[model samples]
Target: MTGRKVIGLREAVAAHVRPGATVYLGNFGAQLFAVGHEIIRQRRTGLHLVIGSGGILLDQLLGAGVLASATFGHCWSPVGPGPTWNFRRAAESGERPVTLYELSLGLLTAALTAGAWDVPFMPVPGLPGTGYTDENWPNGRTSRVDSVFGAADVVAAIVPDVAFVHVDQADADGNGVIPGPLGETLVAAQAARAVVLVAEEVVDTGTARRAGIAVPGLLTSAVVHRPGAVAPDGAIGRYERDVAAYERYVARAATPDGFADWLAGHVTGGRDA
Candidate 1:
């Protein structure tokens, strides 16, 4: 129970998270994503969410009232119009219900790559002149530059704690293969101090040793075995969307009281508030 060990998903949820931790989760839909909703439900951990692109689950986080702060690459969800209402309200009311870190998805990924490689910052494309090739950016807070980057801020993009990914497969030795939503999750995984992987299946460590493993060997700290666990509307083939459920959740999310109710019944699965 000390070093790296394979654990049940709920156990993984309760154990590793601390109150002030930033978590990077990789997914495109429900089938190939970690059960992050459950993870949030079972714990009181304050979180700074770093999402590559938004999804239904992201809205669930905002509705749940437990999310501390958040940053993301995009807010385009296949299901519920991203978290526009949730975000718009939070931004306007200055509620601080969730803190917003604005950076494009592409830039965020590059920063993670640089952070993982131990470089000062990744040299990606975009931005020119002044700091990070400034070339006159809006208020000017850019610190680095490259071909695929402009006004990059590594401090905003780096994951300080762990990235929890739900992968298609993993070796017993904790090498994860996220064939679906790679999303520079490998970089996120490598840069973080630890990676908590929930793999769909555990294959032989020796056979799959050099195959599609994304995160390098040394970076992973633990593997939690949740063979079929995935996020809602996160991935494609692993699981399909429950469309009826999504429709109902949307109406409930329309107002604050409605959202609270929706969070209770749908997102939290009628669990205690």
Candidate 2:
């Protein structure tokens, strides 16, 4: 675990993240809200985001007009199971004009699997009558492949330019511990061209080893020591989700002007230390 570079969050984002990059923010529930906010504050734009569960974090990025397109399972507040107004606004008004590709959790995982395996596509169970099977629905993300068994639906590989995964603990060498269910985070990390591990705590190599590394250091491009990195979303064994904050955001960001003001108050002109 020696020689692994640990940098500040702003430096990490500035060095690796670029405009129009395909980025994956990890963990289905423990989403990286801090990184999303940093991307906004830095005014990085035209990103194509890939998220397992596009929670309020994704909604914030969409609201900030920082994303050009997004591939996600769904977008909503898991707290109230409330609607993400910004996402709804974009979809309904088309004012921001973001291309959205929605997928079932199963299909999204399959796509990541394909990317991880460096395969053209991965066969998944057919969705029968869903729009996924429609040739033009997700715009060529799915196709039918015939085998001796029968015809099967397949999803194209989704490789991100860089993936930002929040971990409970990470060493300077980039080894990370992800407590609880991995969801698609591990595979997405493997599929990404580069990987950034943002940790709640930075420990020594021995501590990281004892914790059991879910993401190996070799796959990591950089490690960022960021406590409360997933604030509002919560990290396993560290903190609880701020449900009130989620509710407050939903209430305040109900309109375009409201969201603009909210962003200014919370994210705009914010300095990264």
Candidate 3:
């Protein structure tokens, strides 16, 4: 069906996402800033975010105070390899509102894999003495499971209510191409209850097929035509990562007042990306 699932970003988010919903954002590098910004703008509360590499995108959402909890592999700036001030502050503060569940990239991917497979949990390497198992730094997502070979550490499945994925090109039916590193995006997309395919360009089915469809139409729930959706993060072969933008954001968001002002000027003001 043509344009059956095609919709605006605002409409798609409003339709699929509700307060306190679990949302998976994007790939390791090609983060969906547009969708994150929209979620912030709408002031959606009590969200449980699942991200591959949280980075500044997750930092923005956390700073906006819209998240009740978050599960991520890591959160930082790749540009300067700088700290995400909001995330750092939240983590360090005793009264931080959000609950954090951190895991290794391997474990996170395994969790998504479990979800995709509709399984109970997935076994991973046991880090018995690490902070992951420490009571003081409890992650609350790990456990031991008895198997044929003995006991194994397992990560719980992570099935998000909705997943927003960035793609280079997409068709009307939601089939798309994702170039470069796949990361956890493919599994996260499959694991999600609904997949919103955000594309830099919308082309014909033949074109998308020729480009090699990474996200099948049958697996996609919606398609949003958002060019430069991953700005500041960049799309492979389309643009380079905006280092200045990252640096400026990191500098401006160092303080609470600075972050508020930056949010006002960039996200909540008028600019979408």
Candidate 4:
């Protein structure tokens, strides 16, 4: 294997992501804590994070003060109906003061789809009179356009500067196989200017090809071998999501002091801890 595409996590993040860049993170089955940890360790600031669903990983970035703004379908913990504490505090109290752009799942998917297709905007039906569309509509990013079909509501394309995804397996060439749900990972990978994949294991090219590549090598800029990269969150067949850890986090991260301690111990001190 040439291993030209394989790189370390730190190098990948430093090379691909810059401060104040718009970043897309692959959530659901491909959520990556490892990449999030590295981003925090490097102390990147003013990042505009975009995720289909903002889960615990997104919370980490928010708590660390890495984000200047966020665009997401939802922001909640995987364990409960409660909102992520950091996100809530930021939005409600202006503690960290992050700009918010909320969209529905369908709109988020459509935006990424438009981005992947390299289109200026994507029309989404049945969203004309919604409250979200009325209140938080992206002014310059979207506009009402009349087409051959008719006038429809559309969202602007979201081509992120870089996308970070954790997959089940990949090859040295950067082709990846995701054994479970694709979620928005595939579209995010295709839409971003660069993609960095963190894999549980790196296999041969033939193996990756045979397994069926969900993310093609051409779209991937770098691949890092990181087993249990999404720990505290599941990776489908690899392991179950650490519900216990998440519960602990939710409990501790509810307060400022508790979150600082948790960050010092787990994130700032050591990633594995």
Candidate 5:
């Protein structure tokens, strides 16, 4: 545990974070949003985030003016990162919206490819009423990703600048394996430049020692131990969405102030007086 082996939270974040850099993220069970918010709370720089299928954390940042711009697929579903289509409509119409750059219409998985590859356009067919699409954005989806050359940047979907992911377990090398197939976490890690992992427990390295990883070891910049990262009220582990909480949030989403109120009650830590 000596030199360059274990690092602090601040050092880990500062290592990969730069102003104007786009970020990808993963969620733990219930405390994910809190960790993301803590980073924002610590850093003074304005961060632009590109979320895949996101959740309340992104919305909170947007509402707080912490995020300069955001692009994502599904963030409005009652579940985590809700439905991208719903967020798109709100953003385009300037209703309950923040400044957002559009990715082609698809899933959060697609957005990662767009930013990592830096593609001007992505073709996605069957976009409800919109039909197939191409967009000059850092977010979009279509058929299976076929490297960035044919599309543009074969490395386009090759990891973002700073990826924040929360997992159940990881080793000291920052090598992690998800409990199971997660939402958009593993994909985000694969496409990010440097990743900061938040794990409940840092375990021994076993199969994780095998390299040729989907998210290579070098790609992992740091690991923080903080359990209960997401929120049981919003996301139901790897099972289902928090139905009741989501139903309440849609109404609160009508205004930033309302969203803040919700956060104050549940997520945000502050004096109640």
Candidate 6:
């Protein structure tokens, strides 16, 4: 859709996402904390999150029991050696655990690429020994294929029900200009059935075009103007990553009670809290 009206974060998320939906949360660094927090606040449950790299936001979803499953190449805080405590706890605990699908970074990218290309699968080399080539893999999403070269493993395409992206700016037409690294945001946006772009600013179409629009308006279902939405995670040149906030989150989210307290005092209290 073109010339889309900018909407509130809550409204955009509520209108686009549904319970038990398979959702893609854009790139690792450009992850939309505002969207994630809104989903939590709205108590949207049974979500299956697809991410390239799972970080604090994914941990929040896991801790809140909003996720039915998670598919990712890896899970860890960008800050340090500390693991994502909630994800770790959920995976390790026998209680109501979130189903984990661990795939290589290459495979994850291949899946998105295949989806973007509207293909059934994308072949990748050197996946035969990764243990994912077997049918026993949790979801049986990968399989071996014979090629002219030899046998190769191909990952099934993953088209999320909805995708959320955070960008530096966008136009009222929903064309987004995402500065810095491209990462997986573009592919995820294209692969999803619907897309929500949360931008720092909504500018004129000419401004967005001149700024080098990375995501076209045709792929965007909605645009949300949310300044500093990706806080605790940098938005390239717009702001620096909040290391202290991330550290605080890690410390507070280390336990269930601590996570609850942090959620109540910080996330649920609004971004400024």
Best by lDDT: 3
Candidates arranged by TM-score, highest first? 3, 2, 4, 6, 1, 5
What is the C-alpha lDDT profile of model 5 across 12-49, one tens digit per residue?
A: 66666676677665642333664566656555356667
* Residue lDDT tens for model 3, 44-68: 9999999988999999999999999
Off by more than 4 A, model 1: 1-4, 28-34, 80-84, 127-141, 144-157, 206-211, 234-236, 267-273
Give lDDT tens digits, candidate 6, residues 1-273: 235467788888788779999999877556677788888888899998998767888888898888999988677888875678898897788874788887776777788889999999988775445466543442666778887888876888989999988789888878999887777778889899998888888898889989999999899988988898888788777888888888888989888999999988877777432
Give the poorly placed runs of model 3, Cα more than 4 Å off. 128-130, 133-138
Provide the lDDT at 190 for model 3: 92
Deviation in Å, model 1, residue 86 alpha carbon:
2.1
Q: Which stretches of candidate 5 lie over 4 Å from their true place?
A: 1-15, 27-31, 43-45, 79-98, 101-159, 182-187, 207-214, 233-253, 264-273
Alpha-carbon local distance difference test for all models: 0.61, 0.87, 0.90, 0.82, 0.55, 0.82
Please give me the total number of clashing residue pairs in predicted model 2: 0
* Candidate 6 C-alpha error for residue 164, in Å: 0.7
lDDT value, residue 197 of candidate 1: 77
Clashing pairs in 6: 3-173
Q: Give the candidate number with the greatest TM-score.
A: 3
- Which structure is stronger by lDDT: 1 or 4? 4
lDDT, candidate 1, 5-93, per-residue tens:
56666676666667777777764333223456665566555787777765555666765655687666555345644344565566577
Model 5 scores worst on lDDT over the 10 consecutive residues at: 150-159
**How do the predictions measure up, each by TM-score?**
0.77, 0.93, 0.95, 0.92, 0.66, 0.91
Model 4, runs deviating above 4 Å = 94-96, 128-131, 134-143
User: lDDT per residue, candidate 2, 190-228, as tens digits?
Assistant: 999999999999999899899889999989999998888
Give all candidate RMSDs, comma-separated. 5.1, 2.3, 1.8, 2.1, 6.0, 2.7
Clashing pairs in 2: none
**How many clashing pairs per prediction, in order?**
24, 0, 0, 0, 31, 1
